[model samples]
Target: MTLASTGTVIEVETRAGRVRGAWRGTPGEGGASAAFLGIPFAEPPVGDLRFAAPMPKRPWEGTLDALEYAPTAQRGDPGVTLIPEPSIPGDSTLNVNVFTPAPGKTTALPVLVYIHGGGYFAGSPASPWYDGAAFNRDGVVTVSISYRLGFDGFGWIEDAPLNRGVLDWMLALEWVRDNIAAFGGDPARVTIAGQSAGGGAVLTLLGMPAAQPLFEAVYCISGAAADVSVDEAEAFGRRLAEAGGVTPDRAGLSSLSEERVLELQKQLTAPAEGGNPLDGLRQFVDGGLTLGPVIDGDLVPLKTVDAIRSGIGADKPLVLGATDDEFSMILSEAKDKLRWIPSRYLLGKVGLTGKARSAYVAANRTVAKKGTAAIVGRYLTDRMFRTLALRIIHARGEAPTWLYRFSWTSPTFGMAVHCIDVPFFFDCLAADKVDAIAGDHPPQSLADAVHAGAVNFITTGDPGWPRYTAASGETRVYDDPSTVIRDGYAEVASLLPS
Candidate 1:
């Protein structure tokens, strides 16, 4: 197989048309491969398309260039880091990036479709860290997808439906179902995985009736199944509409420019004090102007947790968990807010209690070197991750669930920070340049251990760890040296109010 770069192009057949993509080589030159980058899975939502449910892409005549990534969702930069403008055109912001070892070959390999995390406001599959080169080398076909974010993707309108971002995700999955086999992926062995908001998307997909049979398994990192209600989402949408000076209707708001819509989204997505944007920004489940799939009569008639509890998608294996210090990213908040500052606290005044407050304060004092930052990290970590994972693990269920804790500390971040463990799972740890932010190189053995667990899960439906059952309460802790820790943090879970 001939290795190539931007200059090389390969053609791929999609439901819309034959698309061209750039070629890249896997490490050690096992084979030549091609990746279709930035191919729009749905129609551009720009102009008259804004806030509308994702429309199917019209069939094209000949070949389309799939070489570059499309522009990110309307909100643009998710405030995490800078990313380049869309390499392709169109406003719907629905796109996918595919990596294949044998670009033109027809083989049904296991498929791993990835959804990016940007708190539903920001993030793109084009993030350097999301490179799929390593997974290509590992014999799996990988696809990274970008969907609408913020108001454009999730905002509600009195006239429009809910969770447009979710609709985009569903469309991307539909694209995968139709075209992945052409890239040598088994449509039946698909595994949907994500980090943070992306993880939340995974849970959302599991709860979606339309998303059923599209993915056989799901793996989530640092996310939970339940979030805002329909009413909450609608209220947020109303705020966005008022801010944008448009009626909360598709036709009215669709007239605005993509940038304007994105700016309004940014303005409204401000995270509450002491809460990460990912946790703070959510699709409201309210009844109007934001009527998304809710416990309403249609779409999402049941809560996700309830659906799972009743064996809705129990045939599928689920591997979900979070990092030990998932909140380290938000720990940089002001020192004053890190303390007994009740106004901005995520848990609110009523949630913090005597022993719990004392334990938090004492923990803060104990972490003297890091000062209030340590305390803030602890609070956000528990608020964002620990409680959610424990809730899912303990929730009554018979679906074979595997739970894990990403504890491997980076020389730079100390303990697996929020999104730290993602690259390792895709086996592209070295390609993402995360080492630069992580401050130091990760241990090689640690990479191997993490990679092994992911590979096992992808192939066997089990993550090579003990299954989590309410009675047994098993958990796999991933550290520099990994171990199976049974009920390691049960007390922390119990602390959250039932």
Candidate 2:
């Protein structure tokens, strides 16, 4: 075991080769850690490998200087999302960044493998907020992995494999299992976690029989499963091909320029021509994933919730939840436009008409008092995140599961908007751009509490919360003073079937 504290640079051996990393602070000071950046786990998915399953990187001689973040699957950062994640252009984007306090120690530590979320099309793993120094300081080796994104990773082709990104995740986990010991990590103590689409990826993997062997625990933060059916996958493939002026199969798709394909993807997501904009919003809410892992009846044989209900991943201890308003701010602008409209009418605009709408309104009566926009925003949160969490909890059926709700409202957004809770989860309030979303004076004490729970859960099976069960829906609500509620989701209970 090669300990990292002796110098500024540290060396560790991986299956592929030896790599050198830099230490952030002297070990004497608290919160010191070593950072190893851009260690490739797979070969560049370009040219012949483009649109194909990820391939492991071949062995290389000598020590690779892993000093900087690698290229990302995203062409370039769009700067539209709440996360300030950037993208560098390069083909060798499938890599992992490791941060550890005890490099190459025989005393194994827990591992946290995080996947970035961008609705399965965008997002980079190299964000400063994702740096593992904090987790490393807490005695856990942390790793952030990158995968093929968007059409190249998820677009369907007759001759190519489906869910290439999913395969990338599995391969990255295999790499961690194989080489993390060199970084003083226990592969057996690996905890896979992510937020939003990344959350959905972990949930999708949890339900997968083949993916069960990869990780021991899961901490899903606002997971939105994209159970794209084969037919839906085929439809989107044809539409993309039609817009690109190419055949939908591998031959024609492979021939189209990457730039052209990206253009077509935009067109596919473009609002319906000569149609109501409201209809587009409705479609976004009603339509499941247009891109992501598909239920191919083999790799992902069942819907994520269905697979859990059927006892898949029942033995793994799981902790899953979301913020109070994961996407509430999505309706902030629409609030004024919708103010005059009655809540019922606004609901109808989003396809929530008749008895079902009435039922949803009744279940979310508390939100109705906040006006139409609030109701709609909470509906989005519930429908897309919170409610799904309820479904998973009910389905777990005595599995050692814990539930939480990041109920602390953000001062910047005035609501616990999407991605707001991420900084708290990582305990990275000092990271760049955190003030933009979490306010200039975001609370570190909050970060301490939220991140402490995460560290506890990763290190031990329990997260210091009572396990949720069918009889008692125990939950930990992270607020100014985090509290435990016997039924944290009682309001959500009325939303799903008993």
Candidate 3:
């Protein structure tokens, strides 16, 4: 079947049941598309199902409404931000939203499945920045998904399955494989992408044997796999249980209200006494109780980095990137304190001292002019994001990997901080929310370059750049006039702690 006309309703069949979606824009309009929102892919992980691996949604007899977005998992208020973070309330949090150029068609289009990021604690598929209309207009089917988060999804309960969030992702991909053809998506040509914690999920899923067949490519932005040890996860879990005033078991956690769980999560995730204000600011930081996939012997098997080093998904294409000033967003908040810290003290934290510290200081004179906060931000950006991106590139063994560094500094902060590239990559610079970060009249040329490159990568295997190699270390730098650089972070590489 072809796409429905403007303002028309379209119905499609899936293995579980039927869903009715609506056309997003008028036909013949520039951004015309079909949107299928709030389609359940798994049973709500509520009540007894909480903390357990996600189960398949029970088949429904009638067509389900796919017009409005479904409720997202329980999460704390995100406070004020330039980015939009909308959360709805309900148990049907495990859902998927699909957008396509042709909704009821048999033509198998390339698919891009995006996972939202909120440090694994908060975020929703309902965010306006995640709209897939641009992708749909580019001849691709786009899917955004919601998964259980925090304690219910990643807390290490004693008797429950580990990495419930990963399971939710797996179930969503399975649903796509079974039903996306009805929505004009090619199950075999799927590309999974995510940002921050969601990016970490993509890397973790790349390492999972069961998830290998679900997607053909991956795009990880400013995130990496959780490196939590089993002992560390259990210790954090026990601490979380105490914070919630409950026993460290599935039953105890399930008994508590979602509000109480979120309260405990916030308390647990706060920086420890006198800890660096930057500790948990970025998605890669090891903030206690900010739930992530565990290296459970069964589901996770091993650490994601290790799995990648061992050549899991080594044949798959990957696009890995991080912003130049990733931690600047959080550092800007503690500028006063950052000014007082000694350079030696900062260097010591990362195990650099004496000549090593001196060399790093001399090599990074550009950032030194910005003060201690900028220095610290540079260190964390490299340690938490750039280093990880390079390591993954080095580890992927013959996989065609493309590396990029987003250097489009925001007018407000003068740094290409975290999440700044979301709008550029999505080609949504026109969205009002983007003005908060990119500033008014942000360069459209850069957006076109970034978006086109990503679209090229999604459509074909390459993104019109040289594949990354340890020897060459070539990377695309997204700026006013984008340029490719060799060994972009070689100076900072040695200063990183082993």
List the candidates' TM-scores in order. 0.85, 0.96, 0.93
Which pairs clash (backbone N, Cα, C closer than 3 Å) in model 3?
none
Taken over the whole model, the C-alpha lDDT of each candidate is 0.68, 0.86, 0.81
Candidate 1 wrong stretches, greater than 4 Å = 1-8, 26-31, 74-78, 81-92, 224-226, 271-297, 332-350, 355-372
Q: How do the residues 1-498 of candidate 1 rate in per-residue lDDT, one tens digit apiece?
A: 113464667787877889898777542367556778888788877655666778888998989887766766634333463222223345546788898876657778888888877566667787666666666666778898888766666666787767677778888898899889888788898989888778878877777676887999888888744355777777877777778787877866776777787677655554457774434422121111222233433556566566566566677888888876776555555545555443224333324556676555554454434555555565566666677666665553777889888777767655457777876675555553666545456666766777777767876798898898777778888876889977755646535655
- Runs in model 2 deviating more than 4 A are 1-7, 27-29
Question: Model 2: per-residue lDDT, tens digit, 1-498?
Answer: 122344588889999999998888885467778889999999998888988889999999999999889988887455346998898888799999999888878769999999988899989998888888788878889999998877888878888999999999999999999999999899989999998899999999999999888899999999998898899988889889887788888778888887788788878877879998667778887786688989999989999899999999999999999988887787788788788989898778877678777888887788898888898888778878988998998788878899999888888878888888888988888788888888888877888888999999999978888988877788899888888988887766645754
2 versus 3: better TM-score goes to: 2
lDDT of 3 by residue, 143-260 (tens): 9999988767888888888788889999999999988999998999999999887889899988888899999999888875565667777887899888877899987787788888
Model 2 pairs in collision: none
How big is the RMSD of model 2? Answer: 2.5
Rate residue 169 of model 1 by lDDT: 85
Top-down lDDT ranking: 2, 3, 1
Top candidate by TM-score: 2
Question: Could you say which candidate leads in lDDT?
Answer: 2
